[model samples]
Target: MAVTQFNTEAMEQCRTTVSSQAGQFGAIGDGFSNQYGNPEIFGKLGASGAVSSAVSAMDQAGAQEFEAAEKVLRKVESALDAIQTSVHDVEEANKNSMRAV
Candidate 1:
């Protein structure tokens, strides 16, 4: 069998980068709401019918979309977990194989 080289360090770096970025999704989502979706955004002014409905709908959609995105974010975390597990498994397998040689 041909030996395949696994660059553990590169894999680790990629995982670290992706995980660090993924961790920021929550804060970003919250910031969006705080900045744009706050109910007080259009304070002291009368907003009704299509205008109000549109804004409300947009805000709600943003919230729901963010929530759905959070589900995807969780999947990303799970993927990282899976990657870590695979890294460990592969390293162990390589060690065992080396010992057998």
Candidate 2:
């Protein structure tokens, strides 16, 4: 395949992965709001029950976001690798074509 074509394909794939991760982060943010919001409710629920639980809940939400970001970053790295490979392939192909000419 041509270098440009390969790069385009890789970029499209990476974009898809990033879009998926953005949605995941959005969900995690929403969950954090629901699980740890409302100071009045937090006070009523008591420390051991809901108040203390917010710590764990927030941690879990942060972990989810981190995982999603990692996933998206990996995809970007993969895309870069693919582009490099494509460039190498095109260079080799050009050398062969020059010999034929």
Candidate 3:
């Protein structure tokens, strides 16, 4: 059997990094939407169907990217919770064993 040590601090750092990235993704999405997806921009583009479509697609892509980042952040949070639970369980088991000894 291979033994693996859990580094809670490292996990926390990873979670923080992922969360910051997610925030960045959301900011980018918002900026893209504001710059290109606004009604005024569509009016200015004025019946240039191809350009409007492209801008809309880019906006959608940005939104999707932000959503993906948020999902990754959620996964990281869940992993951290699971690691903490596992450590607690192990400590409880160890205490029980010592009590019986």
> TM-score of predicted model 1?
0.59
- Candidate 2 local lDDT, 2-98, one digit each (tens): 5444455766666666666656666665555544445565556555466556676776778677666766666666676667677778888988888
> How well is each residue in 1-101 modelled by candidate 1, as lDDT tens digits?
99777676776677676566555665556654633344455675666344656776776677667666766766776786687788789888978888542
Better of 2 and 3 by TM-score: 3
Q: Please report the candidate that would top lDDT against the real structure.
A: 3
Off by over 4 Å in 1: 32-47, 93-101
- List ranges where model 2 is wrong by over 4 Å: 1-45
The TM-scores, one per candidate, come to: 0.59, 0.52, 0.66
Query: What are the candidates' C-alpha RMSDs?
Result: 4.1, 6.1, 3.5
Residue 63 in candidate 3, Cα distance off native in Å: 1.3
lDDT of candidates 1 onward, in order = 0.65, 0.64, 0.73
**Local error of candidate 2 at 42, Å?**
13
Candidate 3, residue 55: lDDT: 83
Instruction: Candidate 1: give the clashing pairs.
Output: none
